[model samples]
Target chain A: MNEKNTISVATMKRLPLYLSYLQSLSPDAPVNISATSIAAALKLNEVQVRKDLALVSSGGRPKIGYKTVELIADLESCIGSEVLHEAVLVGTGNLGKALLNYNDFGRYGVHIAIAFDQNPENIGNCVNGKEILPCEQMPQVCAQRGIRLGIISVPQGAAQAVCDEMVKSGITAIWNFAHVKLIVPPGVVVLDEHIGTSLPWLVGHLS
Target chain B: MNEKNTISVATMKRLPLYLSYLQSLSPDAPVNISATSIAAALKLNEVQVRKDLALVSSGGRPKIGYKTVELIADLESCIGSEVLHEAVLVGTGNLGKALLNYNDFGRYGVHIAIAFDQNPENIGNCVNGKEILPCEQMPQVCAQRGIRLGIISVPQGAAQAVCDEMVKSGITAIWNFAHVKLIVPPGVVVLDEHIGTSLPWLVGHLS
Candidate 1:
């Protein structure tokens, strides 16, 4: 089986942004959107947009723009949302709780299967009907649920220890929210959510 | 004084990650850390790290490595947190509320000056001691409080309108969380908190 269709992550990242901008346009009717238009919406270069679309195997005509609906659906299939992704979010703090309450994940075919914490006071309770289990049971619960995605929202102090345990329990990808950087072995994927980086742009543009 | 230093937004984004890893070592530190070590922490290429650091007018020495404390201090200074930044968060929904309660902003000198919402019920409220004002009073409140930075967490439908109002009210930079890519003019900077572009590393590492 040829994997030339296997899109790069950078291109995959652009898919959602494209879909989002396309969503603003006609959903039922296919509208041809130029690479320059998409690029302008995304603050990206026009050539970069064309290159990304080409890599995704999208249909684009000369002089005319790409069909919005077809491009969106093609990009969606390219990224593989065919399988429902069950994820477990650890650390039920402000950030974690906010994520649980966020309604958009279902549209992406990803759902928070469970939430856990170290505090016994939180154990046996439920937030958004997802059981809040003890941190000790993470391995058991993760295995039982067949969870592959892990979202870490623990404080900096406990983040590394939790990540090590998560990796051991078979989590392949982690959306890390802790301020600390987790050191994981090769083949494990860690998504570091650094909120501070979003600060400078805000400062530079505003000041 | 002639300014001799300039850094790209991409490099600035990774500084926090490097600094935090250095902080993990604390007073007892490694004599030198290779680009590979930095790459491991960020799930990026060592070549990328070397290229980025090289642009900052400093290179890691062969024998002693980059001085940990000095490197961290330089990264901080490069980010320019000499004075605390004052930002007002508009539309205190789940995201804005989450940010208001976030405790980690102090290290970066980012302080939430105030929070505003369109709903009348949210007005006259206080989040983290910062008053929640009506959207109409933004211009006056922001000017009086010297707020140039703005965070937009409104619904997708209201994002552009809110941003226009913010810019009119004298906001300089906007950290957008509307799940939509904004088209801001050249003078203004718009950084999306969208996970599509935000979690690029996970897709590559996991694939």
Candidate 2:
């Protein structure tokens, strides 16, 4: 990771999505892509894409745009590529399983290291190529793996405890799906994906 | 619905969440709940609650506070009371099923009208108590049931078409979960809940 060219978590979050969009546009085309094209696909301003890309690199010529493979590789490095990031899932509900089945990670260098479920039936099963670890074994495995990002899909009741345990296990970021508002240490990041809160926002500008 | 007290969809979205938080708290305790307390529960501002509530009534006193139950009822009326809103699910993916199984809506007025799936195998069954209707039946069911809100949980590729169909069916608001930006008519509201974009905002704030 280059200390001089660090990217914000905000920019890192968009990389995978942007990569997916860009991949659809040009499969074997040259890596160089225009900020204008990326902005159009993501529905963001070209200036915004340029500003975000500035955090990563500007080696791509303004005429030729950014090199796709190079820019993606650059993004991975910006988000930390020296090591593979291990992700632990808490709450193997429908969403938990859905994420496990999502196979779009190899290119992004993100992998689901393990899954946790209190259900006795699901605890020993292999899900989406990853073994489902018991809830009791979560802390131990997380510590062993040095996992930094924790994904929470548990019910709202168990969400806070899951978050607390994730933080205690040395996790740095939490991608939360539980409808509960988690209480985390000041530095820990929590992303809420509660469909209820989100759906309305999407429709807010509609009518 | 009272014309003068027409609650904006934005305010309606928060009202149910607010009510849930208020109900989760002590019902017997009559202490005046302040905007700050409501804000803390939902991770919003006191002024937001005050302004949102202002659309309904100027009830909350300066320092003393708002009566929880009374405020909840008032907010409910402003959101909706008589005509129950039935919503059609445009895509039946994990996100769609998660929404179907979502039990929180029973408390609020929103009810799952039906779910539509592109796959024939999924078309005949019910998941989470909602029937999975064929995608072909969307326009008919939507018009028949007078559904106005369409939940777009389809893959990004199918988002635009389903949204267009929903709009043609007279739906004015769309809960768009597909990772694509929609070009919709002025009256049609498309609420974007794509975690890819929103998670960044949260990560940036915490980072």
Best by TM-score: 1
Q: Report the C-alpha displacement of residue B199, candidate 1, in angstroms.
A: 6.2
Candidate 1 lDDT by residue in tens digits, A82-195: 555778888987788778777666555567888889888777877777888888788998899787788898888888899988998899888888866677887786767767
For candidate 2, write residues B48-96 as lDDT tens digits: 8877766665568888778777777775655443444678887776768
Q: What is the DockQ of each candidate?
A: 0.46, 0.28
Please state the error at residue A29 of candidate 1 in Å.
7.7
The candidate 2 chain B region of ten consecutive residues with least summed lDDT is B198-207
Model 1, residue B126: distance off in Å is: 2.0
Worst 10-residue lDDT window for candidate 1 chain A reads A1-10
Model 1: TM-score, first chain: 0.86
Candidate 1 Cα errors over 4 Å, as ranges? A1-6, A26-31, A41-43, A204-207, B1-5, B26-44, B55-62, B196-207
TM-score of chain B taken alone, candidate 2: 0.79
Give candidate 2 misplaced runs (Cα > 4 Å).
A1-84, A105-109, A198-207, B1-17, B27-30, B37-57, B75-82, B106-108, B197-207
- Per-residue lDDT over B28-131 for candidate 1, one digit per residue giving the tens place of the 0 to 100 score: 65766666677866667788787765554374786555766666666666555667888888888767888999966766668888898989988889877878
